[model samples]
Target chain A: MTKPVVLTGDRTTGPLHIGHYAGSLRNRLRFQDSHEQFLLLADMQALTDNAHDPDKVRHSLIEVTLDYLAVGIDPAKTTICLQSHLPALAELSMLYLNFVTVARLERNPTIKDEIRSRGFGRDIPAGFLCYPAAQAADITAFKATVVPVGEDQAPLIEQTNEIVRRINATAGRTLLPEAQAVIPPVGRLPGVDGKAKMSKSTGNAIALSASPDEIAAAVKAMFTDPQHLRVEDPGQVEGNVVFTYLDAFDEDRATLEHLKAQYRRGGLGDSKIKRRLEDILQALIAPIRERRAQLAKEPAYVLDVIRNGTAKARSRTEATKRDVVEGLGLFVL
Target chain B: MTKPVVLTGDRTTGPLHIGHYAGSLRNRLRFQDSHEQFLLLADMQALTDNAHDPDKVRHSLIEVTLDYLAVGIDPAKTTICLQSHLPALAELSMLYLNFVTVARLERNPTIKDEIRSRGFGRDIPAGFLCYPAAQAADITAFKATVVPVGEDQAPLIEQTNEIVRRINATAGRTLLPEAQAVIPPVGRLPGVDGKAKMSKSTGNAIALSASPDEIAAAVKAMFTDPQHLRVEDPGQVEGNVVFTYLDAFDEDRATLEHLKAQYRRGGLGDSKIKRRLEDILQALIAPIRERRAQLAKEPAYVLDVIRNGTAKARSRTEATKRDVVEGLGLFVL
Candidate 1:
């Protein structure tokens, strides 16, 4: 049986961090072995929110691509493409936009939350509000049967399916498919400040490509449970950043459990635990950092990979768009 | 001084009608002599409102092209192309969309009036709302300097220039030029049913390629002032469609004024005016219809003209898009 094709992407807003690894990128790495994958660097979608800062987004595109390569994501197994290079995606988005009511876009849970969080309110950019339909185009252009997302992003898939249904119904053509959702294991990575979600804008993130000294400094400054004032006093594990990092990245589950019990028993000091967690993190990230350095040296080679992948992606999309255009009689011939 | 370029287009919603002839197509004929012209068949813009009925839009693309040819929009002087054929337009639109806020789009007078008129209210499609910005992309993709429009559409130019200002302001680069509005002398033509607008869905349009019999039938069914019941009854000429058509199409302005005076003086019959208007229409339309028939034989040639024009247009747009991409530092090298 042909493994279902999966489509996923990220807006080129910033470099990947540990949160991305615990959240979705790790799953993307695993899926490459069994499923067809199309990963996009969504610079166009990024502009919807970052409109004033193209320079920011432009640089981040390379940063995100480097992060992806730094992880275990193989370009040979996965198609990594630039979103702006495909015109059909935007064309498809314009068509799908007609099928979605402004009221419906306003009602999108993810978008609404983003609007509130970004403080855009009614002052949102029109492009930002319409991005879900753009995502529909991205998924449909790839003929992707599956999309891996977090529970929060499942609504985006629902929105894409809504557009798919409406397009088929209105055009009376079944050129697009409804994509299935694959919910990644939502691992909550505490920020350096002990916030629930690690993010770049908040300056709470530990970047995937941070050097050992930077990582060491960040780990040293990380917040721990405030109630545990002294090492002799009993510590709480519920809000501990060191324990959370260990839970997220440690491969030795038994060892982590043993360390947690010792810490709660009021005998383990914070520095010893911090050192152990840092070792585990460096062990995992050292090889990725080495690979990233090697890849960065050959920027031309990395770019060629992205461009070739984009061409491959565009080839698949053109076939689907040809059928779509033919179905609508836009084909002049 | 160099001659400035002019960009104009029609959304492929239906066949071009006499209203289109008086409104914009006639101006395009005049433009071909002095300005470099780019006439786009906006399939992508049509999708904003006609998202569900793509087949309707698809079928209209050919019909609209035929009308352009029939109306003597010269192939040698104008470049006619499809909106979807150029990826650069979509890419440009995506970049521009970021600079426009939802409040700004909502504040557009034309969109506000259309929302009230179409009864879309809050249920308006997001695409429908962003149309002005998309139109800005069409104008700027070719760096068009003169945009011919009715007074009602003048605000679109205002919105486009606003984008140009904001982009230059933020990007710190004066790459795009602000377009000037060229309001056509003759505004909207009323339908046969006496509605202020001639529209296809309203079933009151006389197509540009309407046959002699069809025009006669449509003219006979036209609404005039109700008080003009008898041949000797003094009539109001203000709302008379017969007089309206004469005002728009007739080159003999002194002759038309005399006919209007006779009707207002209670001596001329409606039939006399109708017959005279029919004669005037036939004279203008007869050669146009003949040219249309001759062009229809080589449908392949018509499509080919657009194909070659599309290639030329692509080269022009690709050059601009490269500048934009490079300005944003998206260049891989």
Candidate 2:
């Protein structure tokens, strides 16, 4: 056979950062060579909470696209699509909605956690509640068999599987494939301020497309052990953000181990470690920043990439929809 | 300087009955000449509850269309389109979902009553809960100014207007027109069993496409005043089924008034009144039955009418969606 399809994407609510790179983007670079990859900029999903600020979502669509291109996600090998451009995804979502109950959606731990995190209380938007069904639409519309998602997003894939089984059972045919969630090896990247997660809203993220000066500043202010007060004092490596970045990005394993031992022995200074991290980050991000700057000057060409991918996406989704309509026994009229 | 648009439809769960004619179909025949009309065969909406039975919705699509044509709803003047064929309606619904909260949808009286009526309890489908948003999409997608509905369906119109205002305000432009509810003057045709409503599921309806023998059998079994036993004794015309049918269908005022007075004075028997009703119903439904039979012989021609109407509908909805995309400030990519 045929290669298994891998579907994944990020909501275009803000510019992607290194957190995204560590979590899923890095994994996609390898998966694209073996699988049929479809990367979506989920502008419609972003509107669930950011409905009042559509302009922000609109702008971030490009920002996130630039981040994807900067990270070496080849458009020729991977389809880079905008979620809202596929109207069939929305239609499939509506049909899938009939298969799930409000109670089932309410019981999803991922959505519940998100609601609590956002402090939406009892005023949760219906779109936010029903997003899993829409996500189901996105995955199954392409008949994706593998979905790359973070650990916290496991419930979303579970819900999609349920809808896939339900619709097929209702139609008495296997028209949709059940997708499996693939959690990335590096689950999360901590914020520069030592927070457990790096998020754009927290103002603690180093964006993938940051300039050299911006990267240097972010690395210099990176959080580390507060109690390692002096040049001679022992430093803790457990919760150190600088070491965490080093763990994720640094390729020299022997040098990193030697530095860790030196720091534990109470001779290495915080400034010395910060300077090392600064250099490594600049090396990683400099070329990416330059490529992004070059791509930024050609917005039309970037849009053409998305447009062409969307056309491919539409044809695939239309084929899926034809199966659904046939199973439903509805005449096209 | 142009005629306003009107949107109306039926959930294609069953064939259209005389109840439909009294409630909305009769009104549509008059409005189609003066306004642009779109009559939807809402197969998608039917699946909101009947997910397991796709065949019913699919079959009912044609049955409902035959009824519309039989009742003189001109396909030349009115667009008789299927809901599932218009993907834009679903897209609009997804966008509209962001503007309304889950709690707000839960509080909609129409949905609440439907849930209770269906005995769904806490197991209500998410699609069933979000149908008002879908209905809102259907109305605003065409920019319909008038919506013909029964008295019980008034709340559906209210919810549609709220979504329209919210979307237009959020977009910072009046891209959607607010729709007004138009309750038909002649409300309902009660069931032959004297029930308050004529429903297909209730097995008490006289279908618009019923044959002469079926019509005769249905009228012969109609419920009337049970206490009136003797031909010479006074009969009750107050809650009599025969008098109700005469009130709705019998156009000769003088003869109907005389028959009513004679029946109250005890000269007329139950059989006499039943025979009168049978004759009146046969005359009204004979041409409709004949037309439906002719149309049924040519299914391809009937399908063509729906296909052409759907194309016209698609173009109109695409124009509406363009305005929405522009207002959101999102690039096509």
Candidate 3:
């Protein structure tokens, strides 16, 4: 039996952090063994919001790829492709745009939430507004039946399915398959500052390639219970950044539970918890960082990986584009 | 010295009519000698509005191509290409969308007028709303300096120039040329019903391939001065459909002016003017109809023309896409 095809990727905007690892990367590692996976370097999607700074997106491509490699995403197991290199995706995007209405895109919960958070209002980039359709193109091009997305992003999967249904109805046959959103088991990891979700641009998250010193400094500054000023005072774990990190990264559950119990009962300090969390994080990131440094030296190998995967992806996507075009009775050369 | 490139085409939604001939095709014939002309079969653009009936766009590709060849558009002078077959246009459109804002696209007068006219309201197809960007892609892919458009469509040219400037600014050099809009001197031709513009779907258009009987029937049923019940009755020349056709078609300007004066002063009957109009139309359409019929018999030749031209266009457009991608510092594998 054929394994289910899974599509997942990150926008090439920045070096990914532990938040990405906890939320999706770790899950992707598992998917590589269980499914046929395609990891897209979404440079075009990054340009939707970062058009003025394409160099950033360009530089981030290698950074993100190194992150993927460092974290044990084997190139042989996962197809690592570049978005702009595949012309079929763009063609499919233009074709699928006709299947979706402007108001429908505007009304999308994911897009609406993003627009609000970005404060784009009426001045949103046309590319930004049409990204849902572009995403549909990416999903349908691969014929991926499983798409890993955050719960907040499930609406995009729905939008892709809508386009799928519309295309199928127009063709009087199922030319494309609808994708199911696969939400990862882990929720979002908060930033060290404990103020918002960990994001690359926010400068609050610990990058997967963070140096030892950077990790130590980040852990030292992590927000914990301010009310637990004395060693004798009882502490709260609900919003503590160190505890959150421990919950996400710590493998020894019994010790962590005992520590939490001790902290709630009294006589547990912020520095102790921070020290333990830092030790756990430093061990987690140090080998990955070292591997990343080693991989960064072989630029040609990285580029070849992208080139080969992109070439494979191109043929796959072009076949689907031809199928869609032929099914619609469009004039094909 | 290199000749300036001129880009123009019609939506492949139907066969070309007399309005297309008088308003653009005649000018295109002249441009063939002096300009590097590229005539596009805008099948992709037609899909923006006619997504539900792609077969119409598909079949009209040959119909419009036949119309071009029938009206004496020399293939050696003008490169006739299919829009959908050119992948770079779609790629460039995706790139340019980042340079324009949704509010800016919404504010474009051409798009606004089209939206209102189509009564699309909030339910506008995203592709229809984004067509200006796609058109900008078409213009710039060929580095076209001249784009023939109606007066109302001048705003689309302006929008394309805006994107060109933005792309150049982003590249820190002028990688793309701004296009100038060339409005045809002849105005829109009214339908046989005399109520609206001659359109294929409206059933009032006299197609370029119209038969002798069809031409005669259309001339007979055309709207004229309603009050002119008798040959001796003083008639209105301004609203007379026969006079309009004569003014548009009759080579002898002096004779047409004399006939209009006689009609206004109450001596000429509608049948006499209708007879004159029918003769001119038959003379105009008969050879074209015969040529169309002959060309239609050789589907392979027509398809070959499209194939060869589209192949040439694909290479040219791909080169531009590379330049833009490289200039923008995008990752080019």
Candidate 4:
């Protein structure tokens, strides 16, 4: 049986963080061997929000690639492409836009949440609002059968599927396949400050490329139990960020269980628990940081991988786009 | 002094009608020698509304080109290009979309009118809604200083200028020049059935390529003064489509004035007037029909014109896109 095609990507607005590693990148490392994966540096989508700061998007492309390389995402197994490099994506997005309604885009829950978070209430850019369609193009342009994403991104999958179904129904041909959203086991990692989500703009993210000093500083400033002022007082593990981090990263289940029980029963000091969590995080991130530092010195090798992968990606996207254009009776030339 | 660049085109939904000739194409012919002109066959724009009927758009490409050639639009002087052939337009449109807002797009009177006319209430396609941006890209991609358009399209030019200003201000660079709208001397021509506007879908338009028989048939069925049942009755010339056609097409102003005076005084018969108008129309349309027939025989020649012109267009659009990318500090490679 053929391996199902998987499509996934980063916005390239910043380097990959622990939240990304825990939520998606870790799963991608394993999937690289079993599935046909296409990882994209979504610079075009980044420009939708950062149109005035394209330099940030440009710099982050290499930074994100270094993080991916450090995390053991084998370039030989997965195609790593840049979004702006593929003209087919832009063409497909314009074609797909004809099927999506303005009202439907307005009702996208993910977009609504993003708008609320970004505080762009009334003056939301048209590109930002229509990015769901652009994403539909990105997902379907490869005819991707599966999309690995966080739970919060489920709406994006739905929008892509809707465009797929709409095009198939309208064209009376299955030109695009409906892609399934695969949520990783450790769905999302909370911010160091215990926010519900970890993001670059939140000032709570610890990048995979963070130095040992930076990681130590971030771990020390992590939010913890408020009422546990003394070592003898019982600390809540349910909302404790250190425990959450331990749950996501710590592989030694027996020790974690013992620590959790002691914390609930009392007498487990916040500093002690934090130290253990810090040790686990350091061991996890130290190798990645080292690999990133080494890879950062070889920019040509990194760009060469991206260029080769983007060309391969362009071939696949072009084939899918050609099928869609032919199915629609449009002159392909 | 350098010639100001002028951009204009037609949506390839159907062959050009007499209304197009009288309003825009006629003016384009005159400006072709003096101005740096770019004529686009807007097949992509046609698809926004006719997504399900791309075959219609596809076939009309040749038909529209024939009309341009038949109407004396010099392809060598006036670069005739296809919209979809150049990827720069799509890329620029995506960037410009970041400057336009959904709310602002909703407020566009032309889009509002189109939605109402197309009966796309609430379910309007996102592409149709965002076409103003695409149009802006078409105009500013060449940095065209002037755009010849109908009076109804004045708002589209305003929207384009707004985006131009917004991008320049945001990027802190004057990347695109604002385009001015130039309305032709003879505005919209009335339909054969006396409608306010001539349109292909209305089934009341006589195409520029219509044969003598078709023109004669259309002239016979034209909406005239309903109250003038007898030849002796004074006929109203204000709303008569025959007289309107005569007013637009007939260069013999002395004869037309004499006929108008005779008709007002209740001496000219409707059949005689129709005959005179038909004669004038046949005389004007015969040479155009011959030219179209000769051009239609050479599809290779027509397509070559489009291909060469598209290459020329691509060069200019690429240069402008490069500057915009550089201004934003985006990676050109």
Listed per prediction, chain B TM-scores read: 0.96, 0.95, 0.97, 0.97
For residues B1-333, could you state the per-residue lDDT of candidate 3 as single tens digits? 999999999999999999899889999999999999999999999999999999999999999999999999888889999999999999999989999999999999989989999999999999999999999999999999999998889999999999999999999998999999999887778889896579978989999999999999999999999999999998998867777777788999998889888988998999999999999999999999999999999989988888888888889899999999999999898
Compared with the real two-chain complex, what DockQ does model 4 have?
0.74
Residue range B168-264, candidate 4, lDDT tens digits: 9877889899999998878788999999978888889998889888999999999889988888999898888888888998899999999998888
At residue A15, what lDDT does model 1 achieve? 89
Residues A119-185 of candidate 2: C-alpha lDDT, one tens digit per residue: 9987999999999999999999999999988889999999999998998887788988899999887
TM-score of 2: 0.97
User: Sorted on DockQ, highest at the top, how do the candidates line up?
Assistant: 3, 2, 4, 1
Quality class of the docking in candidate 3, CAPRI style: high
DockQ of each: 0.65, 0.79, 0.90, 0.74
lDDT of 3 by residue, A24-63 (tens): 9999999999999999999999999999999999999999
Write one digit per residue (lDDT tens) for candidate 1, span B3-92.
799999899999888898988998999899999999999988887777667778878888888889988988799999988888788777
Give the worst 10-residue stretch by lDDT in candidate 2 chain B: B324-333
lDDT preference between candidates 1 and 2, better one: 2
Tell how far residue A274 is off in model 2, in angstroms: 1.7
Q: State the lDDT at B125 in candidate 3.
A: 99
Position A165, candidate 3: lDDT = 97
The ten-residue window of minimal lDDT in model 2 chain A covers A324-333
TM-score of each: 0.96, 0.97, 0.98, 0.96
Ranking according to lDDT, highest score first: 3, 4, 2, 1
